[model samples]
Target: MKFSLIFLLLALTSCSKKEAESERTAHSEPAWDASFFSPKTGEILSYRETIESISPQKNLPISPDQIRKRVLKRRQVYDGSELIEGKTLHRYSIYHDGSFTEGFLFHWVNGFLYVVGSFTEDQKITFANPPIPIAHLNMIAGTYWHWPPQAPAGSGSRHIGLEQITVPAGTFDAYKVSIRKNTQGKITLREYWFAPKIGIVKEQNRIYSSGHLRVINTIELSDRSTSDTSDTSEEAPSEST
Candidate 1:
């Protein structure tokens, strides 16, 4: 009886060690290359944006004069790592149209990319109780995932396979993904095309209220530039927004 008890304790210890190792392995192994969507420290991406508003009651598009067009430049700068809500997340400063807009915090765990939170001015972060999963590291055609994990049924993102897309920057093969969300009788659909090394080449966003399209926005990459430490600018149409 004494020997049997010793054996049982040993077995339990062994199982506990195995479980701990498994957890570590899961955290160490990333699903895919994180750089697929995450830009480098000193990379700048310029995009041309066009926005069109539609009248829900009349179901007619707005006048041409009401449509807005502008050039948006986004610069990404490394902001070091921080511990937030018990998770270590990497932060990046986002500059929009040549001014600091916000800090984007990202966490990678179990091969998934999650947006932990965003910080506006002074690095003040507003945490999302549960980090939102933006993409699966190991994405493939038909891959699907939902954000706000507890969101309503029909709210999620899907990979629509790879396709050749053309923008002002030039044509390249890119992965196409579609994201849909439903909230308070309003539905938002966003489609994004990302190139391997280059980030988002194009994005289309449509918002529908009461089953009628209310707004449409399209953004296409106009140019992209990279620098080591200094800011670089690409000449495009005058900036707006």
Candidate 2:
């Protein structure tokens, strides 16, 4: 649901030592462009998504409709670039189906994206100041980063090299970021793929409860459009976290 893109908006900011490792390791790797995730103002990107749910009750019968894929098309456009609290941020307007935001604000800090905050439909700031990294920026095939730099040990992400992942948009050389962990009897795994200049084109998630499959969700980029970047310009309002 909303978590698909919301998680994509949040991911990596490491401490100095880890950052030094990223710099050294990424120095020889293929250069990653910031435009892979951030487009110029007035730019728009579209995607067709399909979500499926599963029922793991082996003894019970499940209807065919319970496993049907729900397909949808979403459009997001970069409104402008703004400077908030001395940090440069990019502003975007996300359209669900064809409607405007229903209390969502996404921003990027130093190229890394964050949820930042959100508002009610009437513009009332219901929740205003949540800083979390769902994804890192300009990462190569060997970089490592985390959402909160102060997170507990062993909970972070690793760049698992680059590969050519195919989707509805076509074949793209994308960087794969993996997050994996097992707690008690539950296993949680997530993978994200980003193509240069096209953005996060695909994502997959799996949850295994007590060694049995609970659910699986996958999203792919079915279609997209990118306009010329050099001519984009717009002034944005000042807002800070």
Candidate 3:
């Protein structure tokens, strides 16, 4: 899965946040911003991910455990950059649950960050606009835009505004972005707090069925490191909206 909020998003479930934690994320303090989504090799960013079930339905129909929250640690490393189609795309390696899996590649087209490409099924797939827009740096408050314009009916996003948020990684004056779409009676909601130079500091994704929440995945940054190691791996398949 292309877990991009820390540059990836696929599908997920929902869970409730700890009492104290819930209060902090509710901060509505207005905020203001740096830059590098592109990093040197060996740069590592780690997050604490919590997966929880919000409805009676299990992630899998036959599963027995239906109520609970499970936390996992996920890390991403900047492997390097490559020239694809005459443009530079950064490659990132993902590590989660003590093992390596799919990674992501990002490139800029006319100044906007587009995922553009990904690795999947042992093959590489390249495309146009991705499911999400990294940032429209020039965007100001009250901005609205849609991703993968071909998104299902009702799918879209908005740059809500600037907000100050505090998490394990520290406090950041970040941009608040929200995305949502309802299709075939299923709805997906995603919100992200992104820091300029550091990328996504916090994010939450929720899926709903028949107007009821089904699952949620929340990720918060815990730590980060920048180095020159070459051990990182790569993600993703082309998605057509």
Candidate 4:
């Protein structure tokens, strides 16, 4: 009887210890960033944060206007894709105002360089020359984008960089992120996390290309600025014309 009682106590203690360890692990994991995806559509978005000039080692203060200046641009040189052989090159620049300039496409196509047929500014939100959906566009902001965020209770950015963020049904992690210009030309590929943060903490497939792994990206934004009009716009009711 004593032996059985002692064994029971040991088993209970071991289970308790294991449970405590798991809790600690979970609690210690860092929170995701704020600007990783398009809030509207939940699509992956990437952008570079360019400063007017480097201020040595100090963290430079970035104003909203400063953030708006740096836009999304892409350059591609094809060595051998099904679309082009040898070397076909393309350079794209997307303006914050939803305007774009494509030297090659404009030089040859004669039509507007929008990937989608043609669109007005407001209509372009969905037609986003890049073809990003409205919902995805909502998640993505002009801020040199970051990661998916945790709720208020889980507030704060995770600096360690999540190799992979996984929930019961989703997962997100990246392998690498770089801009390469080979004989084929310039190509920027961002290896993304398998399952990134979603509406609720969930697991997902790597829908976007991230060089086959979760790419490490610098985090920005602790709490979104309340004074920003963008935040207010998110709260405003949508009106259809």
Q: For every candidate structure, what is the RMSD over all alpha carbons to the true structure, in angstroms?
A: 10.8, 15.2, 17.5, 24.8
Candidate 4 on 1-241: residue-level lDDT in tens?
9899999999999998787555433322121233332122212122232222222233335333432223232211111111111111122232322333222211111211112322232323122233211112122222122222222222221222234443222233421122121222212222222112222121121211222222223221111112223232121112210
* lDDT order of candidates, top first: 1, 3, 2, 4
TM-score of 3: 0.70
Which ten residues in a row are the worst by lDDT in model 1?
232-241
List, residue by residue over 1-241, the lDDT tens digit for candidate 1: 9999999999999999887555433223222454554555556566777777756664445566654455466555655554554455767777777789888887767766677888898757787677776555556998787666788988888899878887887776777889899999999999988665465678999999976777788888876666653445444322210
lDDT of 1 at 215: 79
- Model 4 score (lDDT): 0.25
Error of 3 at 2 (Å): 48
Off by over 4 Å in 1: 1-39, 54-61, 68-71, 78-88, 229-241
Q: How far is candidate 4 from the true structure (C-alpha RMSD, Å)?
A: 24.8
Could you give the candidate ranking by TM-score, starting with the highest?
3, 1, 2, 4
Model 4 weakest 10-residue run by lDDT: 76-85
Residue 93 accuracy (lDDT) in model 3: 72
Query: Model 2, range 75-181, lDDT digits (tens) per residue?
Result: 66665544343334455566668887654455554556555755455544343443645555666566666635555545567788667777766666777888765
lDDT of each: 0.70, 0.59, 0.66, 0.25
Best model per TM-score: 3
Residue 188, model 2, lDDT: 68
When summed lDDT is taken over every stretch of 10 residues in candidate 2, the lowest stretch is 232-241
